[model samples]
Target: MEESLPEALSTERIDGYVDLRSYGAIGDGRTVALIALDGAIDWMPVPSLGSIPVFARLLDGEDGGAIELAPSDPFTVTRRYLPGSNVLETTFTTATGRARITDALVTGVAGRLPWLELARRVDGLEGSVHFRWRVAPGTRFARSSPWVEQTTHGKVIRIDGVTIAVKGSDHGPRGGGPRGLQGSFTTSAESRHLLIVAGTADEPLHLPDAASTDRTIDRTIQNWQLWSSEFSYDGPWADAVQRSALALKLLIYSPTGSIAAAATTSLPESMSGGKNWDYRYAWVRDLAYTVNALIRFGLREETHAAVSWLLTTIKEHGPELHIFYTLDGDTPPEVELLDAPGWRGVGPVAIGNPAKSQLQLGIYGDLFVTMRRYVEAGNLLDAETGRLLASVADRASDAWRQRDSGMWELEELRHYTSSKMGCWMALDSAVALCELGQIPGNSERWKSERDAIRDWIEKHCWSEKRQAWVAWPGAEELDASVLLHAPSGFDRGKRMSTTIDALREELGRGPLLYRYTGAEREEGTFVACAFWMASALACVGRQEEATELLDGLVALGNDVGLYSEMMDADDHSFLGNLPQGLSHLALITAAITIEELSR
Candidate 1:
């Protein structure tokens, strides 16, 4: 017999800001959730990646919704992912006993289940342990409220046409289950318990049989392990590379084959909190990076899927590509500010990103380079895509001299060195592809424009004072993004080496680096730029320094080998979105560079 208790349970906030590194993430390729060390699911988007978060506690604290499982008594906890997979395992130790919680977003054989399913399995490791579980539903980004409903499937929480059904093996201290699936339960060394929270946007959510969900847990583990095995990279830092590959997989929307820039929104980029922005939408640049990483790992399926999706999306939206788009290939909604106080009291919590309207010249190069890699990987480019590629090359040739936002998406429009470099890369890649007969483009226009871009950059962007390429023409400031161009075949010589040294002297924080030369300190070190610096160092023949920098940057990731967009420069706490795709891509690229240099 089981017992039941009240719907509300007491929860203590873990000290100061719950260090973002302390959270473990799990996803089913559609949506993802962040599980804190205390066993509280603090962040998760329902239905899809771009949807409003159902559990926003990671950003808003107590008033925000959360699904929690923790010992009733004082406990110390430790967590890690199952090797080679995203499934997370956390163990809690108390004065009287200990227990382990295995958490996952269960998947079916086809892919992520059409509905949302978060499964937790608890097994007693020693003595008698008392645990409390609670399912608290909050408004979607505090836009609306969730109400309790008694349905044929039992009791559930309904929010925005979605029904959240919580099913589990144990009840509360009183006999029978709690009315709202909230209660406390006790477990012994011989005991095991299963709990599930499943929902759908419109379908009738049902309470899954516990026995079947147990099987689902095992199958999900197998599925992740199987996917991870298909990736083959025997490179230096193989463990970190594989872990980054797994993290990158979490950003892919399996249903649409689009990759999100990151798993979250509104996590602050700076400690002051004004820098927070949503990163859930798919950016063309991010997808390009994702493809490069996937290809280097010898994983063709995802790369092909992503490239096909990009080509099809461009065909539908015309040859000119937006900076970013929804996972379903539509323009993102207008940016909106949520009413809630942002993470750590940062206000102006935003929903949509306005970057779509910005002219990011770097995307042209990003797309062309990705397609080049796709074709080089022995994949055939369709006729329609070939035309698209040629037209894009022409666009790059015409746009190379124009000033626009660079890769960082800053508001100021100037002759950004990286943007011009990217356009040069665009024409360069197109010329190479045309040489190979993969794209039927007039190589003369591309070659002339490419040469002009190089000459212009060498003359205008170089600074005698900084002894390196500045962020833009006639500026003394350094941008870390220029480091990425070293491997773009522009210059891997003395100038590039001097540029590396300048970036380290100005933007680098040890192994970590800032996006550009700035002292406002509104953001942590940009994770991707650090890795790009490492790769550039290797390209400039500073192999020893490159290896050391790479090792230090890789060590900054959390226990499960996951990285965020930025890290707090003061204490090295992860900031912004978790499992950021660009960060993982940089890691993979740096690892591949080191591996090649070793040979």
Candidate 2:
């Protein structure tokens, strides 16, 4: 039997936001939630990752809602993911006793569940530990008002068409009108208690009993371990590489097999705000890196799924590829600014991204590189996919001459050097694939255009004064993105090697590097750019320097081995979204490159 808690334990929120570093994630493949070190689940989107968040306390504070569970006394905390799994085990030590909490967005006996379920299991390790818990669903970012309704089944919070039910241990307020379900219980030594939160949108909710939910949580842990065991990579930094692979897996949308760039949106790239943009969509560039990393680790299922998803999505909407696509493999909606106060009052919490309509020439290389890698991995492209790639190559050849937004997706269009290299890579891949009889294309035209792109870059992109290939012709700014082509085989000569030093001297902050010359003024250093530098150094025969830089960068991740889209140079705090796919993908690729080069 459980006893009542004496008082409440509050999770301190500085200006209504928890530090990004203090959060760990749990997902069921369809959606992910961020839980703070204090045991408050502050962010979770229901129905899907791109769907409206049922808990947005991360963005809107207490008004946005959260599911909070913590010890009722002053306590210290320590936590880690279970070995080879995403299941989080957090231990809380109070003055009188110690208790442990195991959390997960559960999976099913077969695979992912038909409905969403978040399970939290509590065990008392020693003495008596009282705990306070609350299940509060938010206003969907102030878009809807939710209230408790008593149905024949039980008590549930309803907002719009979504129904959320909290089950298991009961105490505190009998009916949580609008404030949501709340309770308290004390755990004695050797005691176990379970709490399960289940939800469904426009469908009947699946309320699994405490026994089944507990069993499912265990099964989810085993499933994650089983998935982790399938991949083999005994390279340097193997632990960090494995952790990054698992983080990337959380961002993969299970239904469509497309991966989101990050699990959260509008987390900000700068504390002062305005740089916040939604990243819950899939980008061709990010997917390419993910595919390469997965391929290198010998993980075939996700690699094939991601490749198939990209080609199929492009085929349906292509001839001209958008920079990104929604998780459902469609164009993203127009950006919508929400009414909620952003994280730490960084306003303009947003949904959808505007970059979808931008003309990013880099996508040509991204698509072709993905196809080439997939084919090289003993995978076959269907007839239609091969035809589709040929058309993409032709489009790349013609579009190469046009001034457009480069990989950075800037509004001021220019002939960014990275864009030219991307076109060069695309055409080169197309010619190679044609020679391999993998795709139907005009080899002569592709080769001619490919050489022209190289000539154009050689003549215009290189800046002797800066001793680097500048961001664009007539501009003296350095861009870290140019480092990518070193690994792409576009350049690994003296020019590329000199450019690496130029970038480090100009853009490096400790081990982290900004994306471009002025990026430090507007945002934190881009996390993926730092990893790219490591890979570029390795590719350019500076493996020793590359390994050293990689070691420092690897130490930058939070305790849980997760990285954000960017990191502040001054404080080393995370900026932008959590568990950034590109950052993790870049880490995986860099480790693989260094491993391959060492041999």
TM-score of decoy 1? 0.95
Top model number, TM-score: 2
Q: Candidate 2's residue-wise lDDT over 1-599, tens digit each? A: 12111122134678668788878898999999898889999999988999989898989985888998999899877788998899888888898889999999999877999999999999999998899898888888878888888888778888888888888754433555565987888887888888888989999998768888878888999999999998789879998999999999999998988999999888988888998899999999999989888888788988988988998888788768989999999988999999887888887799988787899898899989988888888988888888888888888889999998889989999999999999999998899888888898678999999999999999999998988999999898988999999999999888999999999999999999999999988999999999999999999899999999999999888878889999989777888998899999999989999889889
Number of clashes recorded per candidate: 4, 1
Candidate 2 ranges beyond 4 A from true positions: 1-11, 169-175
Q: How accurate is candidate 2 locally (lDDT)?
A: 0.88
lDDT of 1 by residue, 428-514 (tens): 889989998888857998999999999999999998888898899888888889988988878799888998988888777777889
lDDT for 271 (candidate 2): 80
